[model samples]
Target chain A: MSSTDMLQVISKNGKAKRGAEPNLPKKTLLAMYEAMMQTRLLDERMINLQRQGRIGFYVPSTGEEAAQVGSCMALDDTDWLFPSYRVPGLFLMRGVDIQHLVANCFGNEADLCKGRQMPVHYAFAEHKLVSISSPIGTHIIHATGLAMAQKLKKDKGISAVYFGDGGTSSNDFHSGLNFAGVAKAPVLFICTNNQWAISVPIEKQTASETIAIKGEAYGMPGVRVDGNDVLAVYDACKKAADRARKGDGPTLIELMTYRRGPHSSSDDPTRYRGNQADEWLDRDPILRFRKYLEVADMWSEKQETELIERLKAGINAEVKKGEAAGQPSLETMFTDVYANVPPHLREQYENLVRDEGTGHEPDPDAAFPL
Target chain B: MSSITMVQAVNDALREEMRGDDDVVVLGEDVGINGGVFRCTADLIDEFGEERVIDTPLSESGIIGAAVGMALYGLKPVPEIQFSDFIWPAFDQITSEMAKMRYRSGGQFTCPMVVRTPYGGGIRGGHYHSQSPEAYFTHTPGLVVVIPSDPYDAKGLLKAAIRCEDPVIFLEPKRIYRAPKMDVPDDDDYVVEIGKAAVRREGTDFTITAYGAMVAVALEACEKAAEQGWSGEVVDLRTLLPLDEDAIIQSVTKTGRLVTLQEATKFCGFSSEISAIVAEKAIDVLEAPVKRVSGFDVPFPYTLEHVYMPHADRVLKAIEGVMTY
Candidate 1:
């Protein structure tokens, strides 16, 4: 197959070069760029939030803007998105309000998760985004199952699932891929092989040269790309999403990206990683795209200044809006425990009401034991 | 109004439910072509076709574990374990993973799967085939445990289980699979509510609560007690977990004494929970302490089969002891 068939555009610089690109207008591209910049600023600010002990840990999709925003931008609004911990870029590009992210990170009252879940375990059922669990590979299986259901429902849109190199080690990963392949389910598994899983290197995660190669065993096409390059990620994801809609089954795309920050806002990356960090920084997708736009005279230093000011102001407003929502009601605890809470739990909640106002925190250490 | 054996009732229930819902699928070891070791799933493959009736390999974890995954996707999976004693291999997948997924996802997810297995001792099947394992699941929170004693309840409760939106462990007393039969509701739209007990006999002297095969023994003991001039109210606890505490309290209220029986090890059995609840809820109504008449705390006996199962005589003795106290 010709290489151009797999990609719509290729450039080290983010310019309006007219070399076989999509019909996407210049205005749409600029909007996408603004979204990516917003996500980066948000990531940096959230890390500061963590440092100030305002929010808990966060996993930034920082150096991989092209991969995150590009693939997400390619899909329709109705298409299902199953994201791993990172990918705030995709979340922002998909139009999840910045205030919601702030409420989520701060785990406040306005948070859709009811403050019960950890930060980053985002769930917006209306957006077709299934809730994320702390367990790594469980959602891979769930995504496959959801895709199969969509097949039964004859849904026009395809399911897009995100995972990491470390997630591929789970047994469900193999089972999920195998089932989707055999059933010819419309789904795309985008593996953001960011090279590190909390200190475990990609070399240790798999002996295969690329994360996409594992797809061969499941009888699906596996493709490797420059994850930092937004154009490549967009083009590859677009092709796969089209094939999926055509009932061609699933494809695994390995986007070789990097984690510029700590695994979360926690940890010190300088302790273990090598000069590879400096190398990844050089290939930084956002900067490379900015350079390409500069070469085309499509972007300027003034645009960067305006973009930062707009994003910072927008984010600060959202942060204030999120904080003003106040903490989720202590009463939010009783809700979402079940579709219909049993009498036992209701009695416990009533006891709490009778005692003070809301139920005291149940003994989590005794119940969860983990 | 026809009489059927326990296994036949299960077969009838599966056939009826399949005819009712296209999404219900039956998959397990030897459950399709081979008709299951106990013949509980006989003729399902021909009736429902391969897509609905699956004969899986001997992988307990894979069978129950994958059913959990399948059920989460909207298909109703009824997975059968060959024997109650062998369910532990899939217990972690069932109890920890499947049972808790809905709650852990904080109600965002639900797995509606049922694991049907033949349980309890009576025939000379020894420890592996015998053994009552419902106690382990009764302790689990999200799972609904159902053990049917006769054909009537089996057909009704199982249909309820297959449709219910929770992981249910449906234990069919293997020894009584062909032992007895009774009239059941017709037209196949029967659904006995889960977590409710059926009263076999109503009497005011003492209460006898049991389930699975032991309910028959308890009834027989109550019959034998009529000669000795003692009254007994027998409650067949159809659902063990989310147990019918209401029926138990009501029965104990009149009898003023309770004797719980099971074909399981006496230690940490379902009877233990019944005793605790009776003490907690019905302390005022009790004229005597609630006693549990269970099998010895040993691996089910292989050589001494009759001694292994709870007998009518033991039930009678326990009833007499509780009433006199």
Candidate 2:
């Protein structure tokens, strides 16, 4: 009954608990498994690529796939998403091409962001997913605001924002949740409690029993779920989405999970973490979900092995295409400041063009020495 | 054309833009039934209804955060911050989120919103209500900062800002909201382009560059200079960011002297940037060093307000310093 108690459906042994059968179509469940498998493969491959110096950076979403993919599946195509750095599963679920994502990592010309942002800081307007910003919890307010706009227009669409346990401690998270509560904006605040923010543990982040309880202070229903259970995550997110579409206010769902890898390729978990990764590996969401499907007579070991081979070949082709696109042209710096370049920017651009291949024009009256 | 106060001009611009574009919505604290604390959004709710004229909670961050969302969702949100002093709560949303939305998103997203707030020190609202925060917004790259000196410019620039594709910080000079009413064009489509300065007066002796309420102070200082046999030209820098550098350079070239005035703290203020620009480009033609008249680096105090603010006397002194150097 307490909020800290995890809301779970499928048990670790792949058995459905009392009144917890999600009744999802066999095809739908299999699709969820495939998406999770793809995410797992991409996470592993990207890490290898980053370590191999083929890509600049990567943020692996190994343990949190169920939370990311399940919640993403709950929203309609018209709904907007404000994702953080670790939600590549959400992007993949949105039907974004794997090549486009790899291109972003390469900072290639094919990258829509044009090498402006980091590898996993992806965005797609066509899919209505707002770009992921590096600043933690900053997108919560944006998600709230976007939902408010939808509410004003009497649109049934809602916004689902994803953050981590580290994000719940930020002022932006408070401001965003409080506003959504006051405005009665249709929004779902999804906190992927992976138990660590780079180096800081969740115990150090908050004294509260769970991040979901923090939603009560902001006048929203808070739910905690076994994030490793795909059925539980999907059920909770679907209920929250239904409430938002029905004019109910925001809901905060804390997906309880763990980080099964280093925070990013740049980090060294060995320095800070001990046996946690090994411990979480046993409760791997993908493996547990695969057990659920296999118990239901829907999935087999051969199917998974085949799916992985297909995903690897697909990922390899995409990585090769992304690498071949190369970096964006050097002339992209002066554009996009405004819809129309003003005269001053035009002059500066012209100056750069005139001084091509030479060093920048030196200012004789430089405020400080260069 | 009709004679109107700065507040009326702002109100007219909002009404006109909302009438023209259904996507344009007005929102802020007390912006609905209360019609804004300063009446800048008076009766907008009555005309546009509650959906468009949103009365948000007393949360500056919420107002801006929601406005950014609305803009990102293909709506033109003109959010009022009530007072410039109270905008700090939403500063993160404005600078990091709203300003960077375009560039960071690689042009796939744009926040075409106008943040309107009454600023400057004159009505003795104490420190909490009297601060010029344009320099902070101007420091940002993707944002356009607009400060209009009079009713005509206020109406024109607000309309222009609403039409601009990028985010704009429209600073309304609260001190002159009702003073010196001028005839503003009634045309609904009239707009003063952003990033352009209006030369209010032309002279041969020296250049006085100012904007918002200080432009009036500069005009008074120019009057005093005329009595002293010194001619002065006044350039109203309607837009602060993407500054009208050409206008500054031309005025300084003709007069060979520059005097910049602003109500914000002089340290790293807009006046400092303008002074630096003139000094850098027109240094050889200058008859004297560029002089800056600005508020001292101190919190706006309740009493001794005049001493804290840049007044006509200070502008005149700067003119004298620049002319006689």
Candidate 3:
């Protein structure tokens, strides 16, 4: 009786019920199901590759695909995505090429960032994916900056920032949220409450009953959604996105999802809490949406099999293409740090080139002005 | 032109910039009615009204974050950190957020703002108030750091910073705020661009490169050496970013001996930056290694305030050391 009936459409019974909200149009529901499947397969491949030592490091959005893809589907491509480290699923949904993802994952020559950053740190400059950095909450402050610019440019656009519940405790987060609140910047802040920051839990992170309620102090509406239910998250984000585009200011949407996988390839969720993360598997976002698709006569086992086979082939092709580009050599380390490579760096670069000659340079002939 | 202290010149520039640009705003602790602890914001709240001249809470992060917000909102926000030493609380906001906002956003945004803070030792303000921490901000990207040496440059450069399209860290030489008085223009639009250096005195013997209070100290040392027939040229590096390497290289090339002076601790200070430039670009031009007369790495002490700061005597000694070598 206590909060059993929240924002959900296809309940856990695997049957269509009378009282639940009506399903969406066939195309829309099927697309959501497709995105969830792709996210799961992509994340699974990356995790396995990491375990095989084929990739450097990775942070997966495994159990939280519904939170990421569902929220992204609500956003327009013109809107911005200022994500932190752990949201590769968002980039995939935002139309990042699977091969480009593999290139970045391998830190290869064809990577857009030129192999400067670690794997899983993807940035789609043309698609409005603000470059992701390794820092925890720094991107939140930048989201405020971008929202401010959007308002100044009178673009009538919104910026949705993604971070975990843990980042809400950082100074940059506090300053960013406080600034956004005061300026009434057009932004949709989606906190993917995966419930664990590495090993720390939501209880230790804040004493507040819920992270969304903290948005009240900033003078904005806060909405909570059942992060496992794709429809709930999608509906909440759509509403928030609309409010932002209409210049109604910001909205804080707390998606109560779970990180079913380990925090990263390097982490072990079992080291801290075992059954909680594994239990979320039964409520797997991808499976739940699949069930919804089947019940609504939008999907079938035959179509599911074909779609997965296509995704696997696509991923394999990207891996081969990325490996063909090869890793950056040593000289790659020295560029893109500053507008002009200052004389000190130049001298050091020359010294390094002289010290090792062309044999050790990362990209010897690749020279360009800043 | 009327004679006023360096601090007043800064205050006059802020007042004029606000009057000129309707978007200009001033915010900080004690910066409103109290005219700031050093009176830099004196009469500002009265002239500009409360909205433009805001007195904010003691939170440095809040002040800087608010300023960045205002800048993004199409307003020119100039926040005061009160003292360079107290700026650490806002370091995250400045370094991570404000500095990289423009570049990270791929030029989609810009922060035309300023963080004004008093720096250096002379008032015995101990470790808390007397530290010259401009080195911290200078190391950050997208931040234009400028430290004026006298009244004239302070007025010109501050107007420049107020009009700049990037975030500027204006470090006022607290030690020389009232030390030397000079003629600063009243109201006409004048600006010294960032990345340019000024030759305070031209000579062919020893080239002394310095900024902020050390520029005054270098000038004093130049005069003292001139009495002993040791000709000296003094360079006041007004802007640290886009550093005037051309002027510095020219002077060091001409004199064949140079002395770099700063109040910051010797390690990783601007002095080291200048030295690296000289070493990399014009290694053969030096008669002796570029001698750095900087404050020791020890924390700025209240008791030995005079000894701790880079003084006129240290300036002269460093120059003499370079000249003799």
Candidate 4:
């Protein structure tokens, strides 16, 4: 497809175009709609928790649910995902435990990261989901590297990495694409062009006509898809993944979407841009997908109310469990810095315990031999 | 055992590791067919083929970032950064991502990779090609910093680093890459333990602490001090972080006087950390104040490299000054 031409399956009014619907199983389509809805609800609850001072901070992907969920659903179980901080749907769709994810946000004792990282920087190795960092576009090369390793091992798995429009300007974006192109690494570069990166618009992030077109210079096919249409995104991503698995090299996909919320709890988008009009609001991915499901006789107002009620109660219980988990043990600060704790860290830990009047005795064997 | 140069020893370590472990792969600019700029990875591509021995694009961040991903995916990647001076481009990947991978992921993910780079000055490489950038990596936690003074230690330490569970910044003293041949073992199982210091000489007057290329300079200075009727000890710190404080303290307590030498600048260099450790742990047994002989606080000059780098005479002066004080 041309860079300027967008591949859209579902229309803005929630009607599928003629012969454009993806051939996914009914169960898969229902699952995709549920995941998108769950993501939207979770984001709203997390933001409310942040505002209530129950959590420190959160990044809400309000309007970009289809981009995150659809692209993640296209991958096989063995494939790897390197996600941006905004894409919490990727974690949920990958089958991460909701309680674990909530605990990570609370940085509680049950948190897998041991409260070491900031909230939303979730890491689940079982799902083949790489950890998230705050740096933009850095993980792009990492996805390429993982894909290269898979290719070398003759493995059937490919890697997919996500970034925003602003990430297009990062040095690693160029490096990752150029290197992956040269190596013929089986990976997909997915950019969720959500119109605004913080306060900067996409026009200011790049001078190119579109982010997808930039892939042409790196020797990769560029495709643009409707981010509000889950079926379209799934079709594009699955096709790209199949090409990568077949050793045909990488593909660049631009998911045309919009961020309908603030950058974070701390950001004030009102200071920079005017209110988003109703035209943009009507294109919400969850709304469009819900319409599509209803048109297919798959969903109704009764089912929608029940799903929302069940999700709300379930999310609330997980949040309560996370809150009641308590803070991570003080000693967790020193652990995981290395495979074995060196003498220096041991001494420091001892000093901290003594200073805190915890009366904790030093374990002679705890320190690794120097 | 066979006598070999430091570069040859490095090559032997990579070859053995790759042959032993199918997961160990080597990648960098000119590392495949060209066998690296210093020939440290020579003939690796011939044995491992193009899949394992990769010649990547000339992007430092790309090389290191890709290595991080490879390591995360269960491959032991040894990425060479042509020179330590050019390593700044990948500094974010090393410090932010690779070093923090295990901690940030709560031990679910780990980056077990070694970043091999040639460092330090003596070959008139000027500012760009020669620099002692160990202080940067040493200051960052969750990273193992290792340097070797000779071929035997280079091969052994590199092999150990490859097997390490944490990320390692293996700085090779490029100036001594072709130094006098030393007997490096050919056995595949031979490996040196990390976080250990080797006492090269025994002395009663003072102790000289050094690592990498400075170990040879310290040894030369020790001989000069002995010729002047003064005894000095030489300690080679194989690992910079998680320092072998016991070895340092033991040597300092015996000799009473201390002299720290490094090729990096004196201000906030690795030598400062050494001096501080001695002051904190073994201050009561000191005969005189610890002295540091290091490069001046100036950029490495091409024509004046001999003046920029610390020599035996400078180290000898520090030893005499500390002993007399």
Candidate 5:
């Protein structure tokens, strides 16, 4: 494939183009569409929840569901996933307990993070999904390492990490991709080039022809896909996953997608991006995939309605369950620092309790002398 | 027990751990074939083979970030930073990613890895090679900072760090890696518990607290003080974080005067933290103000490397100043 050529398995009209069909099972394709819809509704609910002050923060996967869900569907349950702030679709596709994901947004006592991290920093150990840290491109190297460890153990598992176009500018991106290439680690680095990192456009992020082409510099195969086309994204990921399992080394897949909503609930896209985003609205992966499924005679209007109602009810119930979990206790702040709390920390905790009784702020200068 | 240097002790500890557990792997620049620049990982590649002993590209961030990933995947990766000064590139991986993995995952995932690096100044490595960056690691919660002064402690603590369930920053004192050989146990099961300070010498005149290379320097300073008819107690803090406050408080209570020594710069250094803790718990028992003998508050210089580090004279001066006060 040429460097600038985009690999697409589906066209804008929701029809399989020549040499593009992923040939996934009809059941699997239907499930992928359901996950995309579920993710869309979850993003909408989360954005609404944040606006209503029910949740603290949110980063909606809005227009990029196909890129997130389709690629995730291509991987097996054993393959590890290291997702970025976006891509809740990937988590949903992996069967991550929605309750846990929602509870994390609430940062409640039941939350896996123990209220230590921001919302969307979801981590489910059983799912083989590593915890999400706020730093962009950091997980790329971590995924590479996980792949290396798997390779050392002679395991057939591969690691898939997802990041945004903004992550490409991070030094860790270079470090991770270079190391992965040199080590021939079984890792798939998927960059959802959503065209913006906060307000910074892709044009200003790098002057390179394409993010996928940069993989060549790091000694890895690079491929660009029509990220909005779920089939295309799924095909690219499946191929990369196969290559990784066969010890063909890492591959960088730049999913050509777009962010339909503001960067996060905290951001205002109108300030940076004009009405240009309206053009991407028609390219909605959910709508496009729904049309494709209808042409395949595997979907109906009733099915779409049922899925929407089911997801709305499920997400709403989960939000209520999440909100009801309540805030973590004050003592939780001191816990999880270490497996065993050391003597000094225990004493410090007692001191805090003692100081709390007096209802006064700690005066370290008064407590200790020069 | 076998006589060995800190470097040899470290190599033995890594070999022992790698042999004891199949999950234990060592990775870093020049760690495989070259056996590391300081020879701390010498012969490890041949013994453990290339799979377990990985020679990574010269990228500090990559080394640490990948180690965190490896640790998450249930491997005990002991990654080396070559020198403590080079750890800056991996600071984000250590502080933001590795350290927070366990806490952020609510104990579901843990980075049971050891980051080994040579630290401190004495053999004229200048600024780039010589540095005591323990305070930075100590400042980060969810991280265990260990610095061993001698071969015995180096071997024992290293073995313990490798088995630790959380991330550990093992700062090997480069200056004393070869000097002052000591008896280290050859047993594979030998391990010194972290977060416990060792009292090297017992005295009542004053207490001297130090770690890593400063432990030997403090002992030498105590010897010089003894010639002046003063007896001083010495404490070697094997671990910086989860600091053995009980040991520190106990020593200060007995001596009624404290002198904390460190090779890091004076500003916000480990010595200051120790001094603060001493003042917090044992102020009533103190006869004189706690003194801190530490490096100057400036970047380590090439020409004045010795002067920039806390030597016996500086430590003795603090001891004498505390006594006179």
Candidate 6:
């Protein structure tokens, strides 16, 4: 497919375009829908928790569920996922326990990051999901490196990296794609072109006609897909993964979607943007997928209600458990910095432990007066 | 044991490590085929093949950034930055990502990689080629900053760094990469433990604290001081992050006079940290205040590099100043 042409499986009215749908198993299709629903519920609850001062901060991927979950479904379980902050759906699709995700949000003892990282920066090594960092496009080169290693070891699995349109302009984007193209690394560069990066529009982010087309400059094929349609995302990603596995080098797949909410709980879209575009609102990924599911007799109003209630209750219970678990151990601060603590750090830890609870504690309510 | 240059020692270390572990890979610009600009990776491509000794693009950030990923994937990647002066481009990856990977991931993910770069002035490489940026890495926690003075320590320290569970910044003193040959063990098992300081010269009148190329200069200054009826102790601090505070304190307490030397700029250099450690720990035993002889607080000069580097003369002056004080 041409870079300018966007692949679409499901039409605006929820009807599948003739012969365009992927041949996914019935169980996999239902699992995709469930994961999308779970992601939406979790995002809404987390944002509400942030608003209620129960959590410090959260980044919601409300509108791009299809892009995140569908692309994730296309990968092998052994394939490494280097994701940005806005791909919580990808985490859920990969079977990350909701309670552990909530623990990360609460920065609790059970959190995989042991409260060291900021909220929503999740990492699960067992699932081959690399830890998320705040810096943009850095993981892109890492994915290329891992993919190169895979190629050297003749591993069947490839690596996939997820970033946004704004990330396309970052230096690492150029470095990663160029290196991957040269090495013919078995990797997929998935750019979720959500139009806005914080406050900067895509128009200002780059002068290129399309982010995907920029892949040609690095000797890679570029494809664009209707990110609102899960089938299209899955199809494009699956094709890209196949090519990468065949040693055809990396492919840049741009998932054309929109950020339907504020960048994060701390951001206010109303200040920088006039309003949510009606065109994008109509093309909401979850609603479009739900419509497609309903049209296929795979879902119904009764099932939707039950699913929403079940997800809400499950998420709320996880949030309650995370909150009750409290913060990580104070000793954890000195641990994990090194495999074995140095003498100086050991002394510092001893001093802190000796003076524990002696310092004045700040009021939690007054800490974040937002 | 074989007497060899620092660069040869580094090559031996890499060859030995690669031969021992299939996961130990070396990647950098011109590291393969061309055998690296300094020949530090000479004949490695032929031995380990292009896959292990990779010649990467000229992007320093990509070299380090990709190495971080390789390390995350259970490969001990030793990525060369070519020169420490060019390391700023990959500073974000080195500091924010590589160093903090294990800690930020709560030990779920770790970057057990070594970033090897040639550092320090006296190569006449001017501004872009010569620099002593060990202070920057030393300031960063979670990074084991090691700088070896001679060939013996280069191979041993690099092996220790490669075996380290954490990320290590192995800064090679390019000024002495070819000079100061030492009998380094041919065995792969030889490793100089990290965070321990080696006392090169024992004395009682004063103490000279230094590392990397400065260690040689400190030793020379110690010899000159000995000729002038002053016994000066020289401590080679192989690792800077988990600093050899015990060695520094012991030497300072014994001599009661301290002089710190480094090729880095005088302001906020690793020498300042050494002086601070001595002040904090061995102040009561100190007869004179700690004196630091370091590069001037200016951009590393090209034509004036000799004036920029701390030689034995300047170190001797500092030693005499601290002795008289």
Note the residue pairs that clash in candidate 3: A329-A362, A330-A362, A331-A362
Question: What's model 4's overall lDDT?
Answer: 0.91
Best-first order by TM-score: 6, 4, 5, 2, 1, 3
lDDT of 6 by residue, A183-221 (tens): 999999999999999888999999899998999999999
Could you give candidate 1's per-residue lDDT for residues B202-232 as a string of tens digits? Answer: 9989999999888889999999998899999
Q: Alpha carbon lDDT of residue B57, candidate 6?
A: 91
Give model 2's TM-score versus the native structure.
0.95
lDDT by residue (tens digit), candidate 2, A1-370? 4567789988889888989877789888888888898898998988888877777789998899999899998889989999898788888888998888898888777889877777888989999989888877778888888888898888878998999999998877987898899888899999999999999999999999889999889999999999999999999999999999999889999999998888888888878987768988879999898888888899887988899999999999998887667567655565777776777678887887788843433233321211
Give the higher-DockQ candidate: 2 or 6: 6
Candidate 2 local Cα displacement, residue A164, angstroms: 1.0
> Between which residue pairs do clashes occur in model 6?
none
Interface residue Cα RMSD of candidate 5 after superposition: 1.0
Question: Model 5's lDDT to the true fold?
Answer: 0.88
lDDT of all predictions, in order shown? Answer: 0.78, 0.88, 0.79, 0.91, 0.88, 0.90
- Looking at model 1 chain B, report the run of 10 residues with the lowest lDDT sum: B100-109
Q: Candidate 5 has which clashing residue pairs, if any? A: none
Candidate 1 per-residue lDDT over residues A1-370, each given as its tens digit: 3221233254664544476456666787787788879888998887777776666667677787888888897788768887788888777888788887788876776777767676777766666666666666656655665666566557687788888888888655775687677767788888888888888888998887667778887888888877877777887888899999988899988887887777776667888885558877777788877776677567889999999999999998987786566666655666544345656567677877888875344333311211
TM-score on alpha carbons, each prediction: 0.84, 0.95, 0.84, 0.98, 0.97, 0.98
Off by over 4 Å in 6: A357-370
Instruction: Identify the leading candidate in terms of DockQ.
Output: 4
User: Per-residue lDDT for A80 in model 1?
Assistant: 80
lDDT (Cα, tens digit) per residue for candidate 4, span B103-165:
999999999999999999998999999889999999999999999989999999999999999
For residue A311, give model 3's deviation from the true position in Å: 1.8
Native-interface RMSD of candidate 2:
1.3
Which window of 10 residues has the lowest lDDT sum in candidate 6 chain B? B273-282
Candidate No. with top TM-score: 6
Q: Which has the higher TM-score value, candidate number 1 or candidate number 5?
A: 5
TM-score of chain A of each: 0.91, 0.95, 0.91, 0.95, 0.94, 0.97
List residue ranges in candidate 5 displaced over 4 A.
A357-370
Each prediction's DockQ?
0.29, 0.71, 0.27, 0.88, 0.79, 0.87
Question: Evaluated with lDDT, which candidate comes out highest?
Answer: 4
Off by over 4 Å in 3: A1-7, A14-24, A149-155, A244-248, A326-336, A340-370, B1-59, B62-80, B96-116, B138-144, B155-168, B175-191, B273-290, B320-325
